[model samples]
Target: MSHGSSPSHLRGLAEVAAASVLWGTGGLAVQLIREHEAMSPVTISAWRMAIAAVVLLVALLAVRRAGELVELARSRPRQLLVVGAGTAAYQGFYFVSVTQVGVAVSTVVSLGLAPVLLTVAEAVRDRRPPAAGRLVVLVAALAGLLMVSVAGHASSTGPAPVAGVLLAIASGTTYALTTAAGGSISKESSPLVLTSGMTLVGAVVLLPCTALVDGPHVTTDAAALAWLAYLGVLTMALAYVLLYSGLRVVAPSTAVTASLVEPVTAAVVAAVVLGESLGPVAVVGILLVLGAVAGLGRPAAAAGPVLPDPDPVRPPTAP
Candidate 1:
């Protein structure tokens, strides 16, 4: 069978989609945590990475996989540094952008821009333009994302719109670079090991920034602690594990496009959990995003096969 249609590729797509859904829940978790104890977004993000790194480390030690991490650190320190620092930078820029430009502008610009940039990068690397159908799908997804974001925050402009937009662009560019770097690294390392190492690096990179920006506030409330734990374990650790694993077999462009599921999942979660109503335009936007994702799922005949899974015989370890 063609690689694109192989079971491994489909599974990779599913993994990426699952990761995006988990990421969607992160905002809700943050909101709940803040309800119990006020905390700045940077502090919360720092805690999320730190906690996830710790949890992943404990799991690795328990499973006797710590040696793998050690080996990865010794062998691929540069890739780890790029991915880890890029991860923290993207999130930090995003939060600051949200404060300056508002959630809607930040969300639309940052998230929407990544896939486009990645797609263009892919095309440039391959010395060809994207397929017409793929371009159509990308446009639909971006338009849907814009609609959903604007509908959610129509009047939510921030203090400095231009600065926020620039920061958002930086955030998206950082995300694209990180994903591309991570995709390359995943081909040579176990996703679990990569996630643990990079997240630890990310925590280190973000901690001091968090302290400087938000004073590293710690939450003592039980409810907030639990929510923070959820953010760390599920959203940060597990979701990233899935992402890196999927990147091993999925094209970076396709993977980023699939991850547009994040906003759609967020919209649905808000409606059901937060009693937030999705207006008509937002609902249509959701459909468009879902449709675009579905369209992108089809095997691309023109694009070359994805990288073969390095350990296709080995089953995925539990995150």
Candidate 2:
């Protein structure tokens, strides 16, 4: 679709914003999965992907978009694989982030700073100025997040496990790469087909990987099962679709930056659900993150180390 041209594109942008909010709630759901479901992080990621795949297939059938979905399956197989692999990498590494750095710290490091990286990636990929106004907002948000993390209460899960922190950074990097990849890919493929097809591929990749590391096991406990269901269906499957759709509407940088809200919400949810504490520093960090978001409006327009390409993808010629 043409950038910000059609009314439909504008509507897609709204969808993307809503999807960001939906993704923000994922950490809370995972927290619930931990307490109620008593599942390990590895198990959580595995089940979330697997279960979501099944549910989405059903949803796809019901929606009757199966024909377009089939075409997606036939087209862009390589790109789809890369996107799926990226998805798997993100899931594997993200859990590690929480494991090493503590959920709050890791969340900020990975999710918090992801927008900045994504903006850089988006800018370079598109060869565009990326709008300087957005960069200023992004910097402010980053500053706020840093302060929040510095003063923020650490999760008892411990200072992000050394391994976990590394994994989280790696995950963040891959996530940024995938955002660029997905954005570019979407210019060719339908968003729905792209989202579902990539997810299906992600599930395939995770199947063996999950087994090699974490075996299949079901908890008979009602709460545990319920939490698992929530993560799988709501967070993994549905949330991903929402995010992919949003990517089509929102610029890769804006989409990625707006998503910083997820980690902030995670911090708040951790406090309420995990009973984690955050002092004045926590507030400051949150503000920094917000500043980062606000800053995006500026730097994005400037010629920088990271901004969209001048001619990202050519629009189709009028008939």
- Runs of candidate 2 with Cα error greater than 4 angstroms are 1-14, 122-131, 155-164, 214-216, 272-278, 287-319
TM-score of each: 0.94, 0.79
- Residue 287 of model 1 has an lDDT of 93
Compared with the true structure, the alpha-carbon lDDT of candidate 2 equals: 0.64
**Model 2, C-alpha of 239: deviation from truth (Å):** 1.9
lDDT of 1 by residue, 1-319 (tens): 3424677777888899899999999999988988888889899999999999999999999999998888777777888899999999999999999999999999999998898898888888879898777788899989999999899779998999999999999999999889989998888778888899989999999888866764338967999999999999999999999999999888777788888889888989999998999999999999998888777656663122355667743533322
Model 1 residue 239 CA deviation (Å) reads 0.3
* Tens digit of per-residue lDDT, candidate 2, span 102-176: 765666677655776876665677787556566666666666665665555443466537777777788878887
Candidate 1 local distance difference test against the native: 0.86
Clash pairs, model 1 backbone:
none
Regions of model 1 farther than 4 Å from truth: 1-4, 301-305, 312-319
